[model samples]
Target: MVDTATNRVALVTGGSGGIGRVVSERLARDGMAVAVHYAGNEAGADEVVGGIASAGGRAMTVGGDVADERAMAEAFDAVEQGFGGVDVVVHTAGRMVLGPLTDFDLDDLDGMIRTNIRGTFVVDQLAARRVREGGAIVNFSSSVVKLAMPTYAPYAATKGAVDAVGLILARELRGRDITVNAVAPGPTATPLFLDGKDEETIGHLSKMAPLERLGTPDDVAEAVAFLAGPARWVNGQVVYANGGIV
Candidate 1:
């Protein structure tokens, strides 16, 4: 509800991490003032903000637990005060625990749910209330939901909820001139995705996509940029940026 008619601003949660970093950079490059959000990664967030400033783009670092309402609300207020208003919100901070549903530890499942499910709800609730008209809301999902791969049930379950959030919120925001969508990425080559995988497993996954390669952060960021900035007609959709893996 803040006045943001003159400049576009974007607040990207998890902006210090892999996919989020690239998305923040892409949005900044597109002429939007970017708020780089972090959770216990203020240093990383600062680095992102520095890079954006070096590139002559406007950006700042914001920190909060995505599932904590008070902290996130303060973060949102910081951005609105710093950059006029928030026009786009990208929730990319998520927890991924790959284990068979039956064998998964209850504590682990609870942790994942807190971060992935409740976190999404907290962010979306604030975004729906605060984002200026014509803004976009993007929640990150995984292609695993459709692939139905083994040992991915726990993680996919969380992303399934993400998909639902995007769909329902889009409809709920009717006539707000905003676009709500989810981006489902396939296996991407990032530090987070490559940390524990061996070369063989990486090779196998790379071949899963018809494009014969892993998806890049830029590949996913391009989809986000289009939706957040220019794709006004595209709304209430789950756009898969998985190189046709789904």
Candidate 2:
């Protein structure tokens, strides 16, 4: 066992991009020493770390494939060696390959399952071991699971698995005072959403929400920060951070 301290340490998987980047920055800004983990985007991870540093916060980037257990272990090890025991883990690493279920390829489905469901289990297990008492674990899910939108079957299947895993993990950590929760974000305007779509398509989708706009990284980050900080009473729940998109 490592010596426990009061200062908080947060490890954010997928911290190099999208909502992961925003969450890492928000947590760091809130005075937590952050571990920014990226899968393949080292430069992007460095950029996030630099931004945090320039903002007078401490952070470092560690890269690994979240689907690999050994890699996740080393990533957690780096965080512990650099800061201390982890106090929070926000799992935002995910991949999506969308198509109608009738035409969806099994290979693509397998890939999605491996990255989203299996990867979350691996990360959460490591987090359960590494995080200290009073720690928080925030897992990412998609509001599509609730909306059951078409062409999102495979993706939502994985998130549905995530929801189940996260809820069970929360109860499993009951005596440890660690809270595990999942955030389901809808129509976030991240690179993941904007990388290929035309403006017209994006606009049409944005209007589907009651807020009548796409969500932002900062919007999702705020939810993560809440779960990581003063939301100790909030446990085992899948909170939708979407702008009433469901």
Candidate 3:
């Protein structure tokens, strides 16, 4: 068992699937007591927790909507009550709505704003107030903001807001020794990226990067783990984990 004094406790929002799942597992392997947060995916969260346990790591599942302040407050309380204190918070929970700027459905845009923009605000508010000194707050953004891909305008706008939040929060927490940063991943092989695309489209995107391949969940998780653990000097930055695609 890892020593409690040295083991940090992390609460990863949207920790049940895709890149979030890999991030939760990576943090656990790094000797953190991970609280895997999920929304309407208890089974997936359980599987994540079980995987961590099976690997001789400590983890638990927490459920709530990321945009709900009361629910997220209680979720934070649960993590603190369970593991003593929170040292890292990875806000990976988000929603994506693809459409052109002119014809984008207002309803879909509203939903994305609630989950991606409002959700980041709610989670960051708690993390800023609660996360221990020397801890880190890593928010998920997207390289699409830089790429300016078609049909991704709304989604990119949400991430642009996230990037702004991360940079501002880092300065806001100036004396706390905590680092706030955002990870903007590109063309990752997650359900969020692959769901509606055809094989031909996927293949084309996969080769857009200089690496000539789609980034895996683990690829992005490695960057998050770095920011969460050892990358202390890296703050208020958006580190794009997109294989030089930007």
Error of 2 at 85 (Å): 1.0
Predicted candidate 3 versus true structure: per-residue lDDT over 122-203, tens digit per residue: 9999999999988999999999999999999999999999999989999999999889999999989988788889999999
Residue lDDT tens for model 2, 8-98: 8999999998899999999998889899999999999999999999999999999899999999999999999999679999999999999
Q: Candidate 2: how large is its RMSD?
A: 2.3
Predictions in order: lDDT: 0.92, 0.92, 0.93
Model 3 stretches with alpha carbons more than 4 Å out: 1-6
Candidate 2, position 153, lDDT:
93
Of the pair 1 and 2, which is ahead by TM-score?
A: 1
TM-score of each: 0.97, 0.96, 0.97
What's the residue-level lDDT of 98 in candidate 1? 83
Q: Give the Cα error of residue 117 in candidate 1, in Å.
A: 0.7
Q: Provide the lDDT at 75 for model 1.
A: 99
Arranged by lDDT with the best first, the candidates are 3, 1, 2
Model 2, runs deviating above 4 Å: 1-6
